[model samples]
Target: MHIAEGYLPPLHAVAWTAASAPFVVHGVRVLTREVREHPESTLLLGASGAFTFVLSALKIPSVTGSCSHPTGTGLGAILFRPPVMAVLGTITLLFQALLLAHGGLTTLGANVFSMAVVGPWVGYGLYRLVRRLGLPLMVAVFAGAFAADLSTYCVTSVQLALAFPDPGSGVPGALAKFGGIFAVTQIPLAVSEGLLTVLVMRLLSQSSAGELIRLGVFARGNARQDGQQGDEQGQDRQRKRVA
Candidate 1:
């Protein structure tokens, strides 16, 4: 959810910015180290950022000052970890603010805190938890992606409720209203995003098997299987070329 510019009160905006700045700074450092140490990972990093940008840019009218959409943070968080996602999410929000006007500069911090910070961490946490519980890889991926999308909306609802509390009923009342409104669209959207993320991960497992293994997405046994499959495909291609 992109909170429109100037929608949050001035004091609230400043507080959010302060809250988000440290995370963003830490993310930058982590990203730089990743690229410098593993130059080949650059392409995947770009792809992750693009994935978040494209998916999050698609917004549907939901709440008064915000809209509901897929966070697309889970994939990156799973691939590169949550610290890297904080940076990617911030960059995604910044560009969307400047070009699409989907979110505003004044409210960028609040938006980033919700979609970039809390969402990725929650998703990554669930992913690890499920994987630890002996679930399948794709199952864990779906759970993580679903959690990420839903959590973003939950945080946004809290942010909105806090900023513009109901005059009569106060913060709790405002929270119920915003949370209810968001749940209608957000739940289905989270499910769709989860499935889509699983599909993408499957494709990556096929095409970028080595990279996935290095990133710890695939195990050594899977790597051996992938290597054997690669050898077969290479032999087939050579035979065709000779013919």
Candidate 2:
């Protein structure tokens, strides 16, 4: 969810911008390292950024100058991890701010924290956890996307509450108001995003398994297999870790 242009107070805007800068800088380093190691990731990274821009642009308007939207972070977060998604997510938000007049420049940091950093990290963590538990790939992916969208809104609600506390009720009341607004629109969108992400992942698996394999998701799955196959895959993971 975007806080919209000039919705947040200047203090809040400046604080969030400062807070998000470190993550964005670190993401740049991570992206540089990954691209150096695998030049092929350039196309994938661009596509990921494009995906985020398109999906996030399909946003639903809400009260208090905010809006709910499908954060397309989960799929990329699963594939490239949150740090990489952080960079792509920022690019997507910046594009939207400039071209679409969606989120504001001042609120860029807050938006990034919610949609990029928080959502992707939450999604990636859940995906990794579910995969480790040997769940079906589809199930893990869907849950990750669904949860990521919800988490983004949750953070957005918090940001809004922090920025505009009700005089009588304060931040908690404002949080409920914002959260209520988001819940009405965000739940179904999150589900849709999950299904969409699953479709995309399936397409990627079919058309670009090699790329996914390079990302190490497949290796992790194979490492869960029983007996000698698992042993060899585990050894391979160890080697990758060492390298």
Candidate 3:
């Protein structure tokens, strides 16, 4: 959800910025460690960011002044964890604000809080919960992505309701009206996003199995076994050389 520029009151803007600062800051640290520890992950990280940028850039006008689009954060959140996606989502939003003229700098904090911070965390948590409950990977992925996209809009509705309550019924009425309107377009979009995310994850499972295993997306036992086999093969080669 991209709240329009200066749509939120100044106090709300300040509060949102303050609320979002720690998450973004911690995300930076998490991203830095990921890159420093695993240089090969740079490409994957870039891919995740690009995926977010492209998907989110395709914004559709929703009810009121805001817009709705696929957050594309669930894939990154699942692959690298929510903290890394936080950085990626923020960057995507920032670029969109500057280049695409989609969202405004004044409302960047609220946008980031809803789309970047909350969306990823909700998705990642849902994914983990689903997996733990013995659900299939694709199913869990779909659930996570679906929740992430819808949750963003839900948060956006809350933010808008807070800023502009209904004259007749107050905050609750405003929330209901905004949320109801959002559901009209958002539900289908969320389902589409979830399916798309599942497709992407399937492709990654095929092409980037090793990296996924390294990232703990796949089971660690397989990686450990593979490492042991490699070590044994290396020892055999050394013995042959000595002989």
Give the winner by TM-score. 1
Q: How do the predictions measure up, each by TM-score?
A: 0.84, 0.82, 0.83
Clashes within 3 Å, all models in order = 0, 0, 0
Evaluated against the true structure, the overall lDDT of model 1 is: 0.83
As for model 2, its CA RMSD to the true structure in angstroms is: 7.8
Which tens-of-lDDT digit does each residue in 41-143 have in candidate 1?
Answer: 6888888788778867666444344555667888878987899899999989999998888889999999999988998999999999998998888899999
Which residue pairs in candidate 1 have backbone atoms (N, alpha carbon, C) closer than 3 angstroms, thus clashing? none
Local distance difference test, per candidate?
0.83, 0.81, 0.82
Judged by whole-model lDDT over C-alpha atoms, candidate 2 comes out at: 0.81
Model 3, span 1-243: residue lDDT tens = 699898999999999989888999999998888889989778978987887788676655444446656678777688878888778988888899999887889899999999889999999999999989987888999999999988989999999999999999999999999999989888887887898788767655555556677777888665343222224465465446445
RMSD of each: 5.2, 7.8, 8.2
TM value for model 1: 0.84
Query: Candidate 3, TM-score vs. the true structure?
Result: 0.83
Off by over 4 Å in 1: 38-44, 57-69, 221-243
Where does candidate 3 stray beyond 4 Å?
38-44, 58-68, 220-243
Candidate 2 lDDT over 9-36, as tens digits, reads 9999999888888888999999999889
lDDT of 1 at 198: 89
